[model samples]
Target: MGASSSIPTDPNQRVQVIAAGYGRTGTVSTALALERLLKGPVLHGGSQLLVRDDKYCKLWLDAYKAKDAGDKKKTLKLVKEATAGFVATADVPPVDFIPELMELYPEAKVVLVRRDPEKWWKSVVALTSKATPWWLDVAMAPIPGWRYIPAFMRRFSKSFLGLAGVSDDKASPAELIERGGPFLLVAHNRRVRSVVPKRQLLEMELREGWKPLCQFLGVRVPKDPFPRANDAKAVDEHAARIFTRVLQVWVGIFSTTAVVVYTGWWLWRNKQQSLIRAWKSLKTMDVRKAFGNVWKSIRLIDLRKSFGRVWNFFKPANIKKSLGAVPKAVWPESKKPVVEHSTGYSSIWLE
Candidate 1:
């Protein structure tokens, strides 16, 4: 998705470009570039469908359902309504609906960004992760509004990959990518070529630069270079930022809850008759005295033991087990062991 400030606020804005390319094919860069050229935000699927508005996922879900039920009119209408205010649509679920989108917006120019099949598959493998990690859900659970993202990703993954005839509900995005991803990429580009008329379609690559794209769209090229975004390093940095924020929120919640529970227990243990009096007494207490009381109540030995337990939970062996570092139970006893995870963290610790 484009930055919040870049997204159009007006629901009346109509889509002028339809990106029929699969994701990790410069769709994010295309969305950013289109924002500059078209002077309005473009909808990038996957993250956009869940991150921006809470209702978008539901709308797209309904649209997918309508399409599955052979209700083309309803599907088009839902997609139209869902994408209102965007100047263009790009990436996954939207890529899957190119035919319907072309039917919905006849004037919208389609841009199919192509990548080398082998390179695209490698990128996809590197970029994708499990649909949702257990830690992510646990961290986001307290924030009711943000809790919908994981669920949306899971649903969207199944539906989007279904276009490639992948119906494995339990498979991770990485797993799905390992299974015929190169074929899917080639077939999808071929399908786009067939579905879109030559007059309406502009097939180019990320390395081709802005000239072709600008000429095709009939828009003047910007003075600045084209946007470069969603690359592997950028993606890693973005994920790191999100994880940092989640960790901060989780720590704040845990600390606040612990303090509140301790305070309540202190009040109950003291046999305080009136809640009002207890609060007044707490408020009037000396800062040093209060700190001392809280410290004494917490019991240093117990706190230290709790920290030790947490440390042990995140120990190398435990972390590995939590992340599925061990081989599968289904593997035959005769077969050599296979470790499917990345080795990036190996430099930091040994297991």
Candidate 2:
């Protein structure tokens, strides 16, 4: 039995339902149904780590490390910490630690949610068909803030593939599933049955719906229909929606950044041109001549002030007469006779 030394044993807050099911075996629906029936928080696989608090991701990582190191006590402690506040835990990390969980909370009911293995495998393939590519993993490795996505992908790949004793990095999904599916499903079901007593174990299919689950958990049947969730189509739609929204956001960010950067560069270039023009104009300016003109204006002002009376005495009756102005031109009597050019066109061209 695994030791739970680090976890404070709480009889009152112990997990009441542990859904020991493989992924894509209607585990999501089981989780939702259990939550509604049990009327308490239920931790579903990847829900806590991916959708909920990212802090739980690190906890799972630690638990995975502990499991790999064969430290059952540490693994149990990490599982307890990860699922501390939940009343029920199902799927993934929890499913992997079922034996330890049964030892910790013997009173907790274990529900083995099963489906047709082939159909389950199909659903799994549909859901994970878009698994992050190896190139994407490497590309995202060096990115600062985007490490979580690749980290989650890596951890998820490890947990799911590792459970089936397949290396995701080495094998394609089809190959992994074909080779390991039967053994994985059989082993997991056998292990759960062997560990939990018949009285405390409930084997169920989603098609069986709420009656069995309700009876097992001792909860009144809900008036509403049993939740048939995480269908392959629904999963695909949800993934597409999320992808579209993320793409739109990234496009918007890239566009806004491009506009801002281009505007700043254009403004800087214009300012640079203006500065260059000003410098060139300044360089061409005759500084000595400009200073001379200024000095000459100042001297004229001084002269006007020193000889105000003499200047007025020498002034002519009319300034125009003193400057010898010419009279305006007068027209001759006959329009000065039109002149003809050698080129067969009048000197005075007409429209």
Candidate 3:
């Protein structure tokens, strides 16, 4: 199908632009561009829409039937109405659902941001160990959240379909990125060229900032430079955070279990195995934290403020809403339950 074919006849009709590049494809830059150039609100990986905006997600979930791993537009009519109504929200980068997006938003504008393949490949390769939570590390498996386990398996299938030049499954510190990169870049190129004007999808780098992107998207340039790709070595920093959070959770749970058993006294020794198992479970990402980056990356949320959302979910205080017994935030002076968790996940590492 063609670009005009999927979109409404009105040239001015609101367009849903899916920046379909996998991770490290200048998605952040693209988000900044769309916000500045199109006078559009960048959903930042659809985080705001998917998590914060209850109505948007509900309609999206209901419309698309919220398939975990398959067609994204099962509810196309619902999508068009919901998305158009809240033009403020952006679609998540459903990497696998590109075809559906193309068909669903025929008039959708697609931007394929890519860099030199060899360079991109190297960057992706470097990121193999840098983006995943360390709990997944063989050495770290003693801890749980890092593993993402089978329950979270569908998640990996959803937002991130291995972007390196390799398979997406069980990526080693090295080979994990070999299968997904080039193919993803190629797929994106084909999709955008087939739909939006090739000219519309410029090779705009984040370092160069808003001017080139703004002009292409028909918006005025911003006074400030757009955020660059890989600032502070983002992938590495992210991976570190994953590892750190995993460590915190793992240690937190084991320590909690130990103290509880000792203080309660008379705990059976055989129960130690169960406690250890529970500790491992806690070591996994604090429910909110586990999906935090995924949500941010999928929806491109500016995470500066998302910690509160994550913390709320992880460190819920409200008894009315909690499951797994409300977590008590372990602070230097006190452990206290402080928030409500509505995110449909939980972990022992949380206070």
Candidate 4:
């Protein structure tokens, strides 16, 4: 027999029900039913790791490692921490830790939800038909919680399959579901029966519904019909919503990134071409001559100032008056008109 439960019998145990069944066996519907009957929250599959606090992932991961290491005390402690607040549990990672949970909460009742093995396998295949696309991985890689999905899957799978001593190092949880055959169902049910005491255990199918469940838990049959949550159609719809959301986010991100990168590249290329053209034009010029021209332009400012003063003093009219006053012998030359150029310079021509 597995080590006996060490927990002191608590009249007010936090967890009242534990569903130690593989998923796709009406686990979702069972969870919903239990919530209504027990009047408390049930930790179902997706919420176990997907939606709840990210810290739960670490807690569960630690517990898994502890369990693998054969540290029962530590494993029990971490499992309790991981599953603290919920009144009942169902499906996947939570169901995977049945032995630990039974030990920790001896008062909690175990309900094994079963389906025909062939039908269960078919349901699993339909649910996990689409493997995560490569682009989806690339897109979700930057998301902190999402990036750890693969690692989490591997670890969780190893621990879960370990329960049956079923060695599967090659296949993923999805692949395992597809190829695992009927033996998986058989082995899991056998193990649960072997471990849990008959008095504390209740095995029920989806078809059996409220009658057995209510009688086992000593709760009144709810006026409402037993929940039929997460059927194949509902699973497909949920998958569609997730796919659409992921596709939309990645599309927007990829489109914006492509536009920004192209714009930056275009600007850089044009600027580079301009610089290259400038450099080539400079290479064709005489450096000394270019420097001399620039220097001359600087010197021209001072020369223009001096010339302005001289021009004001020696106006054309003043020059003509001075020439008339001078004798013909002194003037002895042909005179030409003063030409003013557009560049603010005046030329006096004499022949």
Best-fitting candidate, scored by lDDT = 1
Ranking by lDDT: 1, 4, 2, 3
Residue 304, candidate 3: Cα error in Å is 94
TM-score-superior candidate, 2 or 3: 2
What's the CA error at residue 74 for candidate 3, in Å? 2.7
Model 4 pairs whose backbones collide: none
**Judged by lDDT relative to the true structure, which candidate is superior, 2 or 3?**
2
Per-residue lDDT of model 1, residues 188-262, tens digit only = 887888888899999999888899999999988788988887556555665675678778888999899999999
| Residue pair clashes in candidate 1 | none
Global Cα lDDT for candidate 4: 0.70
What's model 2's lDDT at 237? Answer: 61
Q: Superposing all C-alpha atoms, what RMSD in Å does each candidate have to the true structure?
A: 35.7, 17.9, 34.2, 13.1
* Full-model lDDT, candidate 3: 0.50
Candidate 1 segments exceeding 4 Å error:
1-5, 46-51, 68-71, 130-132, 169-171, 271-351
**Number of clashes recorded per candidate:** 0, 0, 26, 0
After superposition, the stretches of candidate 2 with alpha carbons farther than 4 Å from their true spots are 1-12, 71-74, 131-150, 164-182, 285-351
TM-score winner, 1 or 3? 1
Q: Across residues 1-351, which tens digit of lDDT does each residue of candidate 3 receive?
A: 000001123333455666655545665556555655555444453233312334443554454335533455464555555445222222243444455555666655555566666666566556544444443545344443323232232243332344333334443443335334555555545655665555435554555666665665566777766655443254445446555866787788789999998866656665787899899998874888877867778777657678877777776464345664544443455656445443556644434
Flag regions of model 3 displaced more than 4 Å.
1-16, 38-40, 46-92, 137-184, 195-208, 229-232, 267-351
TM-score against native, each model: 0.68, 0.65, 0.50, 0.72
